[model samples]
Target: MGLFRSIVGGISNLFNRNNDGLTITKLVDLLNQGYSLLQINSNIYDIPEIRTAINFVAEKIGSVPFYHVRADNEGNMDMINDSFQYVLTVRTNKYQGPQVFWTHVATMYLLNNNAFIMPDWDNRGNLTALYLLPFTQFQFAQEEETGKLIIQFQGNSSYTFYYDDIIHLQRFPTFKGGASKQATGNYITMVNAMENQAVKDSETSGRIAGLLQTKVNLKSSDMKKKLNEFKDTFLTAENVAGLGMIGSEYELLPFNFKDTPLNTEFLNSIIKQLYNYFGVSYEIINNIASELQYEQFVDNTLKPIIYQIEEELTYKLFSKGEISFYNKIQAETVDLEISTLAAKTAFYKEMSYGTIMTRNEIRRRLGMPKGPPELDKFLGNKNFQSLEPGIYEVGGQENNPEDGK
Candidate 1:
């Protein structure tokens, strides 16, 4: 435990890309120990569609309210406002608020299909702050003796962590769960290649405008030197562009990339597939989702991720004994229809007849503060007593239509 805490204590060191690497000029030396080199290449995050989808999901789920509710064996549940609650509701860590913290976890989870969050502790092992591990990936294995889960963060050096100390979220896992190391790799490879090709084509025009051909004796080495000089003097110069009078000695052979009809429709089809893989749509992200669309989004997309989060937090934050007592974490789902006053009252009217939720609960759902204790009790519906067929008669006597009265 001491070693784990010490490792997490160096969280700042994990993000320091510079000053940690040895100064090496040679290509082979950069690969040596004590030197860290990051290869520059296009990855999934470079794609705009993926970024939009990820940000949309993270924002929607991360910004919602999470409550720490304790239920007794008799079925009475009460919300508990504790240090953990404060961490979840207000501030999560030294630098990040709850939304930022959750967004970080969600983004990482979407990128890699797994994200780990570590709870910072003080000298007495009390929870001080909560945040995601900055590393891109981690390896997990079981202890030989205790069978407890162990985590080694992949980096220049592995940092060991007990699974008990971290909140591990994995998506699309098989039996062993190791295959998620590059979950996005399978989908993004084709998309990456296509986007890279598109980028190269886009950058083609910027590289060179055209070639200058000579009408004179083509093998004049002196003319070749003069041509290079002219290109360096005129074409490559930044300020001189758009209109230049070329000498009749040269014909402009403008180079243009073939206007190949890239299967843009095909690209979009694949993009849609990617979006569906992450469970996002253009409507929800753009704030144009209809009420039904929003509800469906919540049910199909956000609920699964949020459910996983709740289960993880509940199990990790509470011991087995506490879990038996019904200590749990829950997310307060947001409804799009409740934003308007008319819809709020109409929904409240419907719920009033159902007699399930108390007034305070309804108020809380409607974005209002809690009502007085008197309104916290559930209301009884007199209309619910007519389930019996005989009880539905207008008068005390039964109707005699069958008897032809």
Candidate 2:
């Protein structure tokens, strides 16, 4: 039944083949004659009027998109007509009795209709006229070097248009909007402010130096006399800028002291350790300490040895292909977990005044991250959990699923 319907449909199409100006038979003939709607060569080149018409429409639209115009032969023009296609024509001086003639193919797109129709040119007596509907078919031909716009449109009838043609036809308004432009005066004002701050900072440094000499013991002859000249020179010339400590009535240090240099060597050692482990600078270490002073003070002992120990541990772990093991504490040994206790109790503790506080001090010396308040979260992490009672279980095997199978 399907085959019978198909046969009838073919017969019907065959009879009505020529309804749209050209028949299937004529199209086959054109192909056999080596001429198609999309011909490799067209005589259109010789027709200046037609060439002028195409250029006029193209220029009015906008810059010809790079993909639209194509070149093949030395002198040839290829015309592609899609549903959104426009083909402008200019009448030649000599006119044959017209079945139809067209001047300008007005730009219009018929999306739903899916056709490229050439509209009829409005004609008065002397002027010729023709109708153009959106063409249902299109042609892509290699441009020819010469000839009139009239092509031997006899054989090649089946045509196709590219989707790019429809996209190209879209109109876009020129955009001129942008962010507000900064005035020259605004930039000059910023430059001036920056320069003024730099000058003020220089003046402040000078004043600070004067204050240190006058109010601080820095320049006292008696103070100088107490120190060996070599030690004095070393201490004086180092980059040990002092910080002023202002104390309240209840504070441990009740008076405000300015420019009292702290131990430079100690600070430098701390900075060196931080830099070696983390690749930070002295300035960065100082900034971190100032920002989080309590945390910095807690890890005071670590300041001297963190970088070295961390480096050594990392190397050892790599070479051994394992971490140094730690023993897990049993429930009964919970009392031995000194790091968790607030104070020490006299027992079998290693340190004098044996207590959890002392163990914490030791841990701080080892440069560990802070202990957790909740034991579960803390013990869950291997770094913290390893501190439990047992020694490491080295060379332990973890079963592979594949091996078990």
Candidate 3:
């Protein structure tokens, strides 16, 4: 209760001081300005390429499970695999589950260069639920004298927290710019080009029905009325399909379009550029990537993002000693492919020769159920054995010089 009161008092002091230094009102005004900057800039999310890039990264990361781990003094680590299962699998927040929450966070981080998560703590201060704030809705500022970060949410809401209480995932490195500062979105530079192309495409399609001009020399008193009737009938859809004129004096001229249709190759090139910029190959988008390419994509592009999230989560979620003892988050690698029984046999044979991996370990890697407890022990081929002083034995027979004769 005392700690809570102190937090409230500090916030009150932040809001009231208007003349001496930074005030809450001034901060709010600054935040509003920052928000306006985002509004004026074209939203990268609106562009198809940007959306595809963001989705590709976010979905890949979110699909991997995040685990808590235990570690020993000797630096050995093992997953407390099921410890975070409830939080990760059931619900991370009241309204959203872990997948949705993480995907949204990842998407927002890619768009604005930052993402935030506020954990809902129980009475014991353990995390009970989590909420992801919209990146644009919050402004980050630091108190001038104290150097404490202040997070101001939309409207009159404001909250100050220790760095650990809030998960702040930043995509780009920055020396300054507290929380409010944003690194430019990766796709922002191409927005105008994409928009221009879209407009050109639309205009080109509209001109496919070429312009028509009609000329008539009229001498009668009812010429104006006749001209109006002629235009109405001639311009109709039915008449355009099968245009005909009863009078020879009426001359209809069709102006053929000279400009070629928008080059699909050029448009496709732009899309390809966007994909390449985000490290997504055409084979991936078209679903033609081979197994090797897929693995490369995950390792080269996706793994770094997963590592970033892992480091941040590990640091923020646990104390130094606690982390060394029993807390970690890991992103699981994609499942390995064993296409045929021959491939599986070859892989197992290689792994088993030197007792490199136990039977259960191989089974686990192959996604099969665990074997009996004895299978947990390392086993090698009984037929091949090492004899005294580098001598060899094959098929239970000793290759001794005396016995060979």
Candidate 4:
């Protein structure tokens, strides 16, 4: 514990002060011993606070931390923290790679420097000496370029850090303001959502939906635009508003599906048509099939039929109200009606037989047209001629109902 505190204390002191001398140079040299050479802001290393931060990092990492200096005149110092059993070498503009693990660790720890070493902070600040500091956003601004490691900060505000120049972990302010790491809750939520999507795809239709949904092979520019817009909407709205807390002023917010009635209506329509064809209800069919499969089944088979019905429904339905009603069905529902027995036969096996329903039932429920006589004829034929029914005459035409044709 003593050693740990000392390590923290040294780094805090180093970044909190601004001076040029052996202490700062020594800190730089010590960090370099373990890390490979990389470029750093020469001006930054000259600060006393930064030097101290380096020393603290070296002490805590229990490994040599090295820096690369362009000039030979830049003095190198080696320091060993016996309890932690590590050495440190600090330099400038020279190191890069996995060997820089100590550098990254130091940076990660120093991410909280702003909360502790504020400009008007008291020298006797109670929190300054603690190991785990309070949550504060990390800020990253480009300080110097040492290969891929870019030292960035959130704001123009100058704060001392033990290892301010570490890779990837540099502090940068978020667009909404302030610097902060992703919360544990956020991570767990995202992971769980992803797992749920996977499980749903495996058991059902094998497609992605809901939060974090992804579409495959959608390379069109329009699709890309839609995807980017969706991403922006999701990221911008996510938890940043601090909603969902107990006692907060709750608003009747609409869900994603609610805002867009097209998807739901379309789904409802397709499922109904399929249900009619299969002699089942929407709820029964959905209950049996997985969410992922439902969409695919509709897209591949129903969408084209819907398009065809939409093209012809205008002229076919005669009553003014029924015309309007049929139009609504075409606009809102998926059409899976087959024009010929051959087409129906081709898809008979693929079509989900259990719980199939018809478009007319769905349309009537939604106040649409009674649908074409063809729809009824198909339903009648399917019901009577199904393999389960032992292959009866389709329309009293099996034996003598053919009427001497």
Q: Which model scores highest in TM-score?
A: 1
Q: lDDT winner among the candidates?
A: 1
lDDT of candidate 1 at residue 36, scale 0 to 100: 24
Q: What are the candidates' C-alpha RMSDs?
A: 9.9, 36.1, 7.9, 35.1
For lDDT, candidate 1 versus 4, the one ahead is 1
**What would the TM-score be for candidate 4 when compared with the true structure?**
0.17
For every model shown, the clashing-pair count is: 0, 32, 0, 66
lDDT, model 4: 0.35
> Can you give the TM-score per candidate against the true fold?
0.67, 0.14, 0.65, 0.17
**Regions of model 1 farther than 4 Å from truth:** 1-42, 123-125, 181-259, 286-293, 334-347, 369-380, 385-405
Instruction: Single out the weakest 10-residue window by summed lDDT for candidate 2.
Output: 325-334
Ranking by lDDT: 1, 3, 4, 2
Candidate 2 per-residue lDDT, tens place, 105-177, comes to 1122111112122112111211122122223233323323332121112223433222211111111111211
> How well does candidate 3 match the true structure, expressed as C-alpha RMSD?
7.9
lDDT over C-alpha atoms for residue 164 of model 3: 47
378-404: candidate 4 lDDT, tens digit per residue? 344455453754544445565767654
